[model samples]
Target: MEISPDAIIILKWNGIHINATIVFTWAVMVILVFISWMATKNLTIGPKISRWQNFLEVIVGYMRQQVREITQQNPDPFIPFLGTLFLFISVSNLLDIIPGYQPPTGSLSTTSALAICVFFAIPIFGIAKKGIRDYFKHYLEPSIFMMPFNIIGDFSRTLALAVRLFGNVMSGTLIVAVLLLITPLFVPIVMQILGLLIGQIQAYIFTVLATVYIASATRIENKPNKIEQKEGSKENE
Candidate 1:
């Protein structure tokens, strides 16, 4: 079996090639953009709402609520990113049902890209809310000796996120594909259904873990430092 979508070279030069992961990621982006445009084209605030609008509102409301509960801050800043994360993952997983479709989530490269995005986002959000100096200070918390451990934790967590997602998604796809080759119709169908359920669960787990990471970083920024607050008041006086 071709283990990675990246291994499927679409073009090759001296050292350059386009891969299936990039192609399918763009495909997913286009699909999302199209769906969003169609769904919001006729949005209204009246008593009667379009069915698509209603469906979108429900999903948005749920996602917003989840961000609020996790971060306990205004969900507006997070809704776009978190909603897109959930939507892309859930849709990619579900679209495995499409004939001849390769879910990009099954690729380590793709999952690593996602994890890296989260890795960068954590500090970006932290810096935005906490200020650059304070955000970096987190790495030295408890003691300066802990800085190495903090750095290691950051890398390890991102690595874990990428591997966990890729493993679950790729294994599910492989099992279903392999079963299709050897199993009877009923058996393969059962495996397909189970694969679908696993896909959905993975999407949820990834999304929730991402939310938690962002929430933790942003929450730290939101909390006031007692010593700093007292020092600030004395300076003002």
Candidate 2:
């Protein structure tokens, strides 16, 4: 309904710089931490489930399944990071509908920062699992000549992740604002629901893509065994 300020003014030692996006992202992080703690505290494998616990279980299970499918292997290791990403983005996107809250993911700063985290994490996980030399060699990919292309592709994918998320969430925010401005009564409700669906989809897409990237980075390509046997000497040559 109301337009969120592009940035917020923050107190500094010497001066104040207005950066609403950063402040909003900080709020999202705090909320995420609280949610994570609550979920972990009440963890159980029994049939009974609390409301909060059930909600959390649904999200965690979905992300875990997605990651396992993408990697075609167990996803226990990635469950935490990917699950957190999905929950944080989904909740952050919904916050915009609250009276005075704004969705941090709508801001380029927030999405880009998240994408950067994924970028760094991909390499870190790859190196941790496959060793540094092999991890770097993966950038060469299909062939040596494709190294430059593969590197560029990786950078572009990361950039795309940032821009795509920011654009989608911002678009929903702008549309909802415009609808509320035109019809103040009940039209915005529908827009909010639409925003929810869009937000969830975007979150899912982001996490899935991250899982795919991480899987590719960690996958061990089968190498041909170098057994240089004398084919001509097979017949006693």
Candidate 3:
């Protein structure tokens, strides 16, 4: 059985090959863009909004709330990036129920790319909020000796994020495939439903972890210091 979408080449020309991973990833992107356009084209402020608009609003609001809760700061800036990550992975995995369709997320390369985006995003968000000097200072907290280990920790988490998503997704696909071969018809159907649920969950976990990482980077440390000073002044008075 084919383990990865990359192994299924759909086009070959002039020594270049296009695989199922590329095809499906683009397909998912197009679908999302088209749906988004359709949902917003006729957006209404009154009580007569379309169901699609209502559904999208609900999703966006929930995501914003999640980001706010995690970061304890304004959620507007982070929504676009975190929301896209959640939507893409969730949609790609949800599409696995379609027969003969391989989720691009089942491929390691795709997951790695997503993880790398998150890896860079950490620094970008950090530097944006704290400036380059202050953001990098965290790596040397307490002493310069810890800087190397802090850097290694960042790399290690990025690796974990990629492998975790890829392994869960690929394994889910593999299980469903194996069940189809040996199990009766009804059994595979149930597994497919379970797989869809798992896919949504993986999307949530990945996005939340990313939010936590970015939140850590962007957190302002001055508040606690000020609170302590106030307390000390009160004690002195």
Candidate 4:
């Protein structure tokens, strides 16, 4: 199939064209808002919980465990930010399962937007916790000469996150669609299930990497105290 590059709808306002990707992103945001409202409507710690509530709780618990395991520390402080990220990305990716619904994260625009959020968030949170000077000083870690390379590499990781997510989700959607078109038999069903599995795993992987990056940004590294070392050497002498 010869798919046109102009596969997206364009809306013009004041000579500015807003593409389908933006529209899709807005749609996902709306869905996210609704889901959030619904999930928080009736909160309780009772024996009788709705299935929806239970499911959401299970997801939250899993994310908490994963974050703790990855960071080897209490993830309570990071829960709200990382948990929302995991939920949003996972749900966005799974939207493909709905007929006629395309996943927002399948496009580079959406993935890049999320990656950019993480990019900005890492620095903002890092500086907030460690002070602006100290946070920037992190780039010169182990030596000041490595500053340029470290800065470049850090930004490059954000780009990698965006591209990796976009490529993986888009490939899964395209491949499954192609198979379904070619043979409408039992093959498509199998492919769909496999796609679902891949989608969930990819979402987990993306979120985990994001958590790791944020953790690194906020982590405190042990530095040797020159004064203490000198004092110890004088005592030894």
Candidate models: Cα lDDT each:
0.82, 0.77, 0.89, 0.74
> After superposition on all CA atoms, how large is the RMSD of candidate 2?
10.2
Pitting candidate 3 against candidate 4, the one with the higher TM-score is 3
Question: Each model's RMSD to truth, in Å?
Answer: 7.9, 10.2, 7.5, 8.8
Higher-ranked by lDDT: 1 or 3? 3
Clashing pairs in 4: none
Worst 10 residues of 1 by lDDT: 228-237
lDDT of 3 at 97: 82
- Using lDDT as the measure, the top candidate is 3
Q: Which sequence of candidate numbers ranks them by lDDT, best first?
A: 3, 1, 2, 4
Question: Relative to the unseen true structure, what is the C-alpha lDDT of residue 62 in candidate 4, on a scale of 0 to 100?
Answer: 85
Tens digit of per-residue lDDT, candidate 2, span 1-237: 334335555544466565666677778889888877887897778998788889877867777787787676689988887877887898888786687667878878788988999999899878988999999987665689999987897788788889889888989888878888799778888888899899988987888778777877777773212111211121121
lDDT of 2 at 12: 47
Q: Give the runs in model 4 whose Cα sits over 4 Å from its true position.
A: 1-6, 16-18, 222-237
The TM-scores, one per candidate, come to 0.89, 0.82, 0.91, 0.82
Which candidate, 3 or 4, would have the higher lDDT against the true structure?
Answer: 3
